[model samples]
Target: MTDTAQYQHFNVFLAHEDHKSEPYHKYLKASANYETYELKSSLEVDGILYVKVPKTSQPTWAKFAKSLTNSSIDELQNNSSSAVLIIRAPKATMAVTFGYGRHLLDMECFVTDFGIKTALNTLNHDTLRSVDVITLDEQGVQKKSQASRSSNVGVFGIDISKDLLRGVTGSSKAGVGLFNISGSGTTFSFGKKIKVKDMPALVERIYSYYQSNDYKDSFAWVDNIRRLEEKKDIEPLNKKLIDEISKTNPNIVISIPEMLDWDTITGFSFTRTKRNIKPTIDSSDYYSSLDKDNLSIDSLKRDRLFVFDSSDEDPEYKLYDCLYFEIKGSEKTYILFSGTWYEIADSFVETINKLLAEIDITSLEFPEVYTWQETSGKGKVVEKIETEGDYNERAALEKNYYVLDKKLVKSSRTTTSIELCDLLTKDQQFIHVKHRKGGSAGLSHLFAQGNVAAEIMLGDRKFRVAARSVIRNKVSKDIVETVPLEKLDSTKVEIVFLILGENSSTLKGNLPFFSKVNLTKAYENLRQKGFKVTIGGVDKVVKPMP
Candidate 1:
């Protein structure tokens, strides 16, 4: 095809759901550069085809891509030098399929969650921007950006990004194999290749750690795998697991119920069995009611180690009615529960196993546990009341700074949920101020509240309008001149969890592990929704008032 004709005859095919196809068409139509084609039973001509698939329909999309290779469709032919396939999905399977299909069809593919924006930007050289974009080279290897040309290093055929590889190796050029790249120019290889299916999760896990400023542990994890070949030490294993668990939010504690060898196990009593199968009983309602009855015990059990709702508070319903256990070992005291296996302390496996062996037979019995009472007055309702300390911190920030406000008032006709977040700016900065005399556990509540407010700001449009209205009413004259509502979308919202305290030493040392992980996860979650997120202490903000 002639150069001029190639440009003239460029065709775009859109494969998307009926609801999502309009935007793709609209953007393509606005480009005014290429001819668009619709998917048909039979085809006649070939050009650059753009495929937009939702994350839920990735499997079907993959199958469709595979079908194109074997089909006898004459229109599927590419007149240009290369055909383009864009797969927009969050699932790793779609990415793998895109990579595989690129090789099979001799087409260049771009994989992203940003969808048609990235595709249109690349094809038309439009000024539109996207967060992250991945493209496959001629060899079917994934590239983070178009600038990444080298393909020497890859895990399980999926090319590793330079940032990820550099974070692991701390260098541009590094050998690929089963090995640990260390600081002192040391390499230890495990001699086993990671499976292709497992590479996505592994890469994401490592890259998240690398991104979270936990590079030391990321490197140690790779090194520990090699160490497994030489020796079976529990220390490295414990460290490796603990590091993995730390990245997750809300903390996970895993435990196995202790039972004596001689004790006879019995099924639930008739009353208990009736409660379980009752048509009127919602499991959550029953559990929550139980929590109210056990409020005293729950308060007594609440320590600096971990927080548990007497009932299952986790959105996923993974956490249930399980008592917490503090497993103290040489390294760290890990809190254990029955629901999640993520945050179990290091040395727990060895120590717990030993403890289980020494359990007395006489102590074995069906333990007395609190059940939900319908008429219980003492409910476990820990209302988050804003304190004087919170007001003081807000005053300090507002008095010291010009660009922010203390209270982000969300106005309604009847009522407004007083957002714990104190400082908000017209530039879309959302700051939550927390002043606690206790340990990092208090900071968790702050983080949780901050995250919730951030979510509301990002998702709830009613709140957004109300917030803008409140800003105009409250701060337009006194706090600031006026509040602009233009830059207040998800992309513009920036969440800051600011913890104020006198004990800087303790906060600094424990904050990174205790608060940083949850905050980082929150940051990531918000970032995925196009909002910016950050976590820090009083030092990053203003000085703590004496």
Candidate 2:
């Protein structure tokens, strides 16, 4: 806890599965390009460093502090730099890492999450510092929390403790790409500061604790989590995602990622729109080297974004901000969230599917009369989609559904414009049709739009006045006779979201996981407002196979 115990603040690492047999130095390399380090732990080298000697980086600001003009600053300040140190226990397979040496080891060579398990083994009132967690969802969140104070700090966050915990690394945070990973019982990280007169003793204690299995299940309530990066664990998962990105498909979506968990931070106000998410359009702009075989996390550090408004202070984001990818294999479904890929648990996926089934999205058969033509891009894949205006007009003429697509009416309530619906029917079904291409983000926008239009139509009289005028004059006066505006019953107004796509199947299985969250929220709100809500799907027109 003091300067006397310089090695006190260190991270404990367990050798990756079967990596225990390898020489201690084999697991990590010295970061200095032109230098080499003796892999053994020499007590002379800061009592823990594996390098031949203690290599303290010279702080660039040290010169200014020692200058003749103003040379009175007592303590020398050092900016962050990395140094490698690893101490392996003579008894078992454990490595004690000090300084920034944790970065030098390959993720495949050792396990980092055991540190959390060690924290739980501490006495109930012992000094526990912080906890990190990753959510086992497609959102791929990583969060570091110090919710507990020194005295009240137990094994977990008591009031904040919930279930569904897992272990993962490689997050896409806003500035440093921190994925909002989820918590307690089992955390992504757990640590407490303690003095160690000898480094080997600390290694033995951890190795014994892991080997004993006594306290292992003493916190069995917290073992609901598992780590995948212990040994070559993430390679296969990364392989699947890389394949999708190298090609083009919904399996991988590379766009501007929204910032997460900034709302809870106490410093300043932050909004999603405050910093525009720059889409990672072309990968070549960030880097010329595209590794098809291996992934280098450092490459992403160079890929940054600076286009936040000059006048406004905001979270600095990277160009390769965040990525979302999902793949259904022969057995389990895998989701790549943030920068880490996790295997979706079978029970978890089933639980979600069961919940989704109860949501009751009405699937009315849509009229399939449209055709697609080669307007741009690839062969049959890049066919120009029929616009909403064209689709509604044709549907009205050919099928008798009233076209209300572009009848934009300025609302007095919101002081903004509102489009009632794309098509209206005699039975009071107000349908909103949209082309499904932007993945979940596009669908979320549509759901929100549909929900708002329904709210405006039902709640606001002025919105209805503008809606009535636009429908009567712009859309059709005769159509209003069937569904009168003066006595528009909220119950009879059916809000339908007709999503058109060539490959999407019935808006259920193919719907991105995150979109389902938005869809459920919109659906519940509309239903609570006493309006009938239904999800409708139509096949998009695609170029005929030659």
Write down the lDDT of every candidate, Cα atoms only.
0.33, 0.53
Q: Compared with the true structure, what per-residue lDDT tens digits does model 1 show for residues 1-546?
A: 211212111112222233222233332323223333343323222212443221222333455666757765444332322223222223211121121122222111211112222121122121111112221111112233221322222222322111111111111112222222211101111122443233334333322322232323212222111111111233343344334333423132221122111111111111122222211112232232333333332232331112222343311112222322333447554433222112233443343334323322221111111122132235522212223233444444554422233454453422547562666554555666554322233444566667776666555657666666666555444433223344445765567665543233344334422333344445556767886665444322222335
Residue 526 deviation, candidate 1, in Å? 1.8
After superposing candidate 2, which stretches have Cα over 4 Å from the reference?
1-8, 30-48, 51-99, 112-231, 236-332, 335-340, 359-365, 374-382, 396-430, 448-493, 502-507, 512-532, 541-546
Q: Candidate 1, which segments miss by more than 4 Å at Cα?
A: 1-333, 336-399, 402-420, 425-427, 438-441, 478-493, 502-508, 512-517, 539-546
Indicate the worst ten consecutive residues by lDDT in candidate 2: 262-271
Candidate No. with top TM-score = 2
> What's the true lDDT of residue 367 in model 2?
62
Instruction: Supply the global lDDT for candidate 1.
Output: 0.33
Worst 10 residues of 1 by lDDT: 260-269
